[model samples]
Target chain A: MIKLAVPRGSIQKNVSEILADLSIDIPDYNRANRVYSYEFKNINDAIARSFAEKDIPIQVALGNYDLGIVTSWWADELLIKYPHLSIENLILFNDSVSKLYSTRSNDKLPLNDNLDEHIIVTEFPNITTDYLYANRTTNYRVFEAWGNPETWLNGDASIAILPEEKLTDNVKVIDSIYQGGLLLIGNKKNLKKIKESKLFKLLNEYKGLSSRSPFHFFDNKINDYVNNTKKIYSTRKQIRIAIPDGHAFRHTALALNNAGVEIKGYTDSEVIQGDLSNNVNMIINVMRPQDMPQAVSLGLYDIAITGRDWLKNFIYNYPTAPVFEMHDLKQSKYRIGAVVSKDLNVTNVNEAMEVWASQGIKKIRIASEYFGIADYFARNFIKSEYQIIPISGASEGFVPEDAEILVEGTETGATLEANNLEMKDLILESTNCIIGHKNLIDNVNPLIVDFINRFQ
Target chain B: MVDTLKKFQVIEQLFRDVLNANNFTEIRTNTVQPLNLYTSAGTLTPSMLHGTYSFLDWDGWSGERVVLRPDVTVPAAQWYLNNMEGQEAKLFYIEPVYRFIDDKNNREIWQCGTELIGISPETANEAIIKLVTELLGKLNLTTAIKVIITNKDNNLQVDNYDSLPDESIAKRLIKALGNIFDKHGFNYEFIDASQNKKFEYYTNYAFSVIANDTEILSGGRYDNLCEGLGGKKAYASGFAFNMNELIKLLSDEQ
Candidate 1:
């Protein structure tokens, strides 16, 4: 299947025109209220998805899509990070004539001097990493942004790399990366057929499309890094703790409040990095509880607070993994259970199996983000083998349509009740708990242990 | 360093037993080879060369650099061309190949599969598909495997290894190969080579075996790879199972 991706925002209109000129049209290209993606009914057999400008390059690189149209800056950004991903630069469609340059408010940061004390903020961390490397400056901490680069110049940062067009009148250009524009990148997986196909060759010869490709070497002062030089972290005499973000944030805040540990800059902020007491260094960073198990076991974080259910799910798959559950905070309580339609008489695993067997369903479909939990549950409860269809969210919605049962983390059971799904098997109860690396308990300082004791 | 060697051994032995039944002799090639051979064969890229563990020629062979063989196919081709001399030969091998996977991780790959040299197109097609299917069956996969076949003639180009004149020969070969696939009752789908090409040296067909949405075994026909390497023109076909993938899948199943 031909899967193509286009950047959703900003450059959408320009690319829509370029695609139109090439006789490859996407429906509702110019409509302001148009949906994120469209499938062309024209002779071309393709499925196109509209992704965030930065995500387009990664989607194309991972071979999820055959082709992607993204800014050259993002393409260069991902290439610098993942050089081995098979992405071929097909042709440059349009030149936005925008150079990725660093801007300053009033005091322009010197290029050659020790940027050691300065804060370098950018939306493109990999590109900033390259810029710092090429300039031979390592004494700066890069502050990654979720949005608004200009707002950063007024605050903690002195320099921010934004597009020339996006820069404000108050911001002055200090340095520039190479000029980049719209680039057509093909996946390495699709290279075999797409690059060699005669039809693709004809499509590459589109009129009004600029022949100049921005993906090339630079001879100018904006030099490229010979190799990627990642900043080495100096060993600090501080403990690292990761607090779960998103749904678990409120519970985490409440738990910290009760424990008398001051974690500043968490509430009313999307900040990933925050500061905590000196007992725990680097403040308290936020990450998904789902990712906490692997991260803590890898010793990236000395301590983490996540759901015991999540840890249970991890141990279900990898029992020998090095994860130590230190304390159960009794926060963010939830139940891991299977839910089916309320209309059905099924109330338990054996009853669900009976219904599935009576219906002569050979392979029962179960949906869950926790595939290991679902698979283990299905295998143990049902004598017949079942197919576990993974879902990211809204596991209850799939119960009546795509799946017969949904194995989900049920909190309050309101959403399940609203969806007309009845709780079947109460798999396990879960709550936010303190976890540490079994092999790295010594790394946790005494102050951190005392703090955990208060919570227990 | 990988603890999955036991899993590799199980799959490798199954492949050994299957290929032995088909009268293909198991052979071992050198762990290291001349870097020039791969370059001369028009298969080596600068990136691949940079990834290879090559050094100053200590063997006193006129400063010719050597590397730990990046793939079993090249060494297999060189061996066939040197010994067989265009004679029909069927060989299978299970060995470690070194290549660039990424910057941070180890590049050593455990490759195990069959290599056919100086064989007819019809015979090679039947042998290659059967061997790959047999290996997949031996893995005892939880689900049925799907084979995505790239038509040999769909990507006719002026590549270094093209020995055929008209495209009609590739057409007939495709039909013959399709028949062989049909006879085995293999679940297969056709995709053009222009969409998903693997090796630079593949001139005819390339196919990948997928189960659980993961590509486990991949290989294709390199009809003129021997001739491109300055050997006598001979038809060759081979397939290799990434033994690590087999081990991972089997481990999860067990």
Candidate 2:
């Protein structure tokens, strides 16, 4: 079932009417005063009433709900915080939303004044802060607001940032910071599903309902609910694990959970919410060799999983605290070997050596991903007679095309075979492995041990 | 007043004289290359990324890719695989290599080297040592040139250390050994059955020459290079001079 967040009160009625026009009957939404939640009778749709528009984006991003009808302003604001999440549908609400600005200064609001040193109070910090910063207005402070600009602006604070549509008769928009529009959004995965589902067609037909201009509004009811729940659940003992959303690390976490490990999974998005506070047990980071040493030095994760190639290239030169290989998952199949144009007459290493000796071939160029390996070959076997060309990816394609002989990683040799090349020699076969801090391995947590044991 | 040009002329003359006297030839190749060449070598691995530069070729027939030839051996071997018609050929080249490294190391290094393809092991070894020694002789450094040799058959059977997830520790250990050897003023040591370099291409003997803790020359017998390049069973051996290191050593002694 697709759960949706809809703004409560008047916006909720407007949404229900729009759904009704689309032949999606949402019953007793307005008549029933206690109806803060409603489900579609015909379609698999459930709507929870939210007093604040800001809650929709957060809910969709957190994967708590599948779909949401929210202002484009909020969607844009939330997307900046979670760039990985894509906006599903932009159903432009006919509502012309205006951004409101207020100043406590007795003098007229200075729209032209440099806002670099100004403090702007707003509950929507993500959007408002980014908008100001992106425009080169940096020195502004954002304070969370309880209800509206009036709540904060009328008090000690003079200036505030808020959605233009929320400007009421009591306050005026000194200048429209941005025009707020309506947007439909879902979780990235759910958005894919929604696009394939029949509901997408129904929503498109009723897009005209998006024409209504948004009314001045402000609500902190959702934030209050979430904060209170968080406080109550503070004792629950949440353990965080940072994993790239789609990497194998995330799968490993699931496998651990299935094996009875109670750990909370967090993506790059959720990391900024707060410190893991001794709760983060592991991080599975993937990057090239140059990044591994730095990542290890950060000391954020008790344990990390990365490639050995990274360890050798960077860590060998720079010493860091010792790390241990907990388990070798044997993934990311990497093989370092040489491949040449199929037409080359040489068939063995000996032949290649003789060619170097008698042919007056003073310099031989080998293309490979392994510079150290190439260096080793150049220094030892080829007697430093040839130049080793270091490449980062697609080493096989270099043969006869860009390079004479290519030294690269191969798994099934399908890429080489596809390119009409064959492996002349087999260098080494490798797979992804899991590693951890040396101290952590000794004081090994049961969860980590269990996770590592899976590979064993 | 002409001393500086004469010195530059001497350096150039020394390089040419050594190549001509050793029966070495020269070749010029591209400076920029594809990214996968180094990634596949198992030597540079992902960790030694400090010396290589990469860029995406958005306009070329090939899609976007990273480039900058970090070393010259691979490019020369690549040339042999494409141009050489038979299993037996002798070639030599002197070129500049670009590597990205931290500290005050030179990004561009001059490599004076030779490659012996389709040759016997004994002949290849003789050629490698002869070329290296000749190059050293041209520089006429006061320090002794020592060749430390190890056979691939004698080392541990581990393959491709660079691709390992925790390769840094092992690589560090090896580098430490190099440092230890340098500190003790040892000429050379044959690495026993337990120690093996990360590249998988060496099937025979491998060696590097060090002077004052700096690697002045390195070479080995790669009998498998021909077979790896889809050629007849052939033996290959060669050595390269760190022209930069050689120059430094020469200048330091003066």
Q: Give the number of the best model, judged by DockQ.
A: 1
Candidate 1 residues lying further than 4 Å off, grouped into runs, are A1-227, A230-233, A269-282, A441-444, B1-197, B200-254
Question: What lDDT score is found at residue B176 in candidate 2?
Answer: 45
lDDT of 2 by residue, A259-360 (tens): 454345433332221122233543232222323332333322344545555444333333443554566666667766667666656885546657655756
Chain A TM per candidate, in order of listing: 0.54, 0.40
**Error at A208, model 1, angstroms:** 18
What would the per-residue lDDT of candidate 1 be over residues A1-456, giving only the tens digit for each residue?
567777767788878877777677667656775355567656366667676677667667757678888888888887865677788877776665757777666543222122233455677876775565445442344545544555445323556678777676767766766677788888877887776654355458765355545433233232222123222233556666777777567668667877777666546446343344434444466666775675566455678888887777776756666787888887668899888888777657688778778887777878787766887788788677777765445343456655788888877888888878978898888888888888656555775677688786
lDDT, residue A255, model 1: 70
Candidate closest to the true structure, highest lDDT: 1
Chain B fold agreement for model 1, TM-score: 0.77
